[model samples]
Target: MVGCDDQMERLLEDLTQYSGSSRERKFIRIIGMRGIGKTTLAKKVYNKADIRSHFDFRAWAIASSQHNVKKILISLLRSPKGDTFYIEDEADLADMVQKSLKGKRYLIVLDDIWSTKAWDDMRLCFSSENNGSRILLTTYNSEVACSVGTENLSL
Candidate 1:
């Protein structure tokens, strides 16, 4: 939240824009070195009053270097509701995530991503059907940011 007003405003504008004109899903990548406030800014934007009301659902997931797909999916799925269920298969977990977010406009924040592979694996769970759904990610790697085809904020 320190000296991030401009960046925060830009991100909020991007996030709240109408995406109905296209079928592609929108992604925002916040990139910065460790000890910077990348995650802090994302959390502030994600929890804003306007941001909360703009989407039907909101989920926050932390992706560490290990990149466990199942664990990530489960964390995302459980965020909307406090449901506790065990799904041992990755495909099933992906399906559940897809189903839960199929027709709903959602705001999902993937924090601390280490690689593009993690983004690729998680991207499959989202459907791009003109739903104004957005995926916000924070990473330290420029390569991962570039792979996702989006301009990232370097802090």
Candidate 2:
């Protein structure tokens, strides 16, 4: 973040800003080439003390080259006692995730997301409540970045 302090600050400000009655959840995408600091920057913002305190719940998931929506949903729905439901059904898992974060202001980091389809599958698990909840995504593909979010930081 040495050379990217300004970028980090901008992202932080965006995440903390108020969205006026936009019931739709907000997304902030971090985009850059491979080996660049896209994921690093996203992690920095995601782990910030103030940022952690700002949200009611937070979860980080990696959307690998072989992305699995069920696996991603499970990561989002994890509890202190671990898989409270322990079911194999994707729809049920997604419902659990939605139910858990329904009224809470959550911060979800989908790190290294590779495709729009991956986002499409997982987006259903989140609610469109106007509670200032946010999703921060990292990707190497500019098209994917643009398709998922209007607010983005290009590393």
Candidate 3:
């Protein structure tokens, strides 16, 4: 993180900012070329002590080129005991995630997201309740970053 102090600060501010009126779930997109510290920055922000304390639940999933919605959901919904809950249906898994996270402040990090379809699929697992939840996405594609309609941190 030699030259990433500024970007790290920006991400921390974005992650912690709040508005009294609208506590809707927000997306913080990190866009840059491959191997340009996108994932590294996201990891640093996600692992901060204050960040861990701020959210009721935090999950991390890697969405590489061959992203699978079910797999991603499993990663998000895994228990602290390292037990992987098995569910054959994707919708059922997604429902479990939503039900567990409903009305709670959560942080979901989708690292290495390669396509808009991946975001579309994973976003469904989260409820858009005004609980100040957030999704931190790291992608190498500008198009995928812009599709979320949020401010992107270009690394």
Candidate 4:
């Protein structure tokens, strides 16, 4: 943690600024090896400061070695967001998630992603909304991080 505390803090600040910006979409992907605290950092950031004073809605999904977009989406949807649950397929779940996230500055965190396909499918749920909605994705693959970010992530 000490290795990049300042840098992480600065990045968090920049994201906070973007959260309030009346501009484009803001998507952030945080990647690192398993047990290296990517999930921990994402949780702390989402609950404490990252979503503070900015995000109108917040959702998190845990994608382990399995890829069940429907179940994950149902979990987040049925949370405090007041969304309903269903046994729909991935496409339907994705549509619900997208609708629930629309027009709101949301912080959608997908933790412990194991496959690129899961990210690809879930990405359909998020839209720019012009409210600077942010996506904080955590994975162990450098490619996944790079695919969703302008630069690679390491810790």
Candidate 5:
């Protein structure tokens, strides 16, 4: 770890281990109550890491208590993911996001999700044939993480 802060140090370690060694496509939820630094920690790892160059592409989606699938897909497709840019409809956006992710390893941050459906709808986009992609999901619900999979890159 490169910081004097112990919490930051621990976060650094966890991010390094997960991104470097975890081969399977993963969903990590930083579960905590409000103001517990879940988003802060995930942001630190996202901003101050060498993982970007390690992966083929990096994208971020800002989820809310109420979110539409097209909005999320549009945001995730903004980065260099090789996906066609059409987000007027939910089906079109989802298909483009999935098609663009083929053969590429991606690091996607699904921040501030509130339900399992968010993961369910978007899981197909991250589940690549190559199997080297990763999705970092930050939420306040443990059940959301567990519902997706127990094997998570949790904060």
Candidate 6:
């Protein structure tokens, strides 16, 4: 955690702020080259005691290079609740995710996203109803970070 205190504090401030007046959902992206500590920083924030108490639901998923929408949704869904059944259809899976996250304040960490398409595909499942929900991700590509349309921190 050396040299990461500042970054962690900044991210924590942004994440824990009140967004009650904003209609849009908040997203935080941590971008950096390989071997940097983007994932570590995200985990540190994700596991924080304040963060855990702030959000009603919390989920963590690894996007890696190959992004599987179903698997990601399943992981997200399972985090707040327990295990969920396997659904064959993509739409059904997405609908399930949306339903699960619908009125709850959630913090989802998407680690190692490799592409904008992956983010776009998964973003549909999260409903932005001015509920102060947040999606935080770590990525190697700056383009991917920018495409998320929110504050991005470079490590």
TM for every model, in the order presented, reads 0.94, 0.91, 0.95, 0.84, 0.79, 0.93
Q: Estimate candidate 2's RMSD in Å.
A: 2.0
Indicate which candidate wins on TM-score.
3
**lDDT of each residue in 32-128, candidate 1, tens digit only:** 9987999999999999999999999899999979989988998999987878769899999999999989888999999999998999999889887
Model 6, clash count?
0
> lDDT per model, in order?
0.87, 0.84, 0.88, 0.73, 0.71, 0.87
**Count of backbone collisions within predicted model 3:** 0
Per-residue lDDT for 88-120 in model 3, tens only? Answer: 999998999899898799998999999999988
Clashing pairs in 4: none
In order, how many clashes per candidate? 0, 0, 0, 0, 0, 0
Give me the runs in candidate 3 sitting further than 4 Å from their true place. Answer: 79-81
* TM-score-best of 2 and 5: 2
Worst 10 residues of 6 by lDDT: 16-25
User: In model 2, which regions exceed 4 Å deviation?
Assistant: 19-24, 79-85
By TM-score: ranked, best first: 3, 1, 6, 2, 4, 5
lDDT value, residue 92 of candidate 5:
80
> After superposing candidate 1, which stretches have Cα over 4 Å from the reference?
19-23
What are the per-residue Cα lDDT tens digits for candidate 2 across 1-155? 68999999999987878766464568889888888998888888888999989988888888878899888888777732365457899988888888889899888999988988898888878887888889999999877887886788888
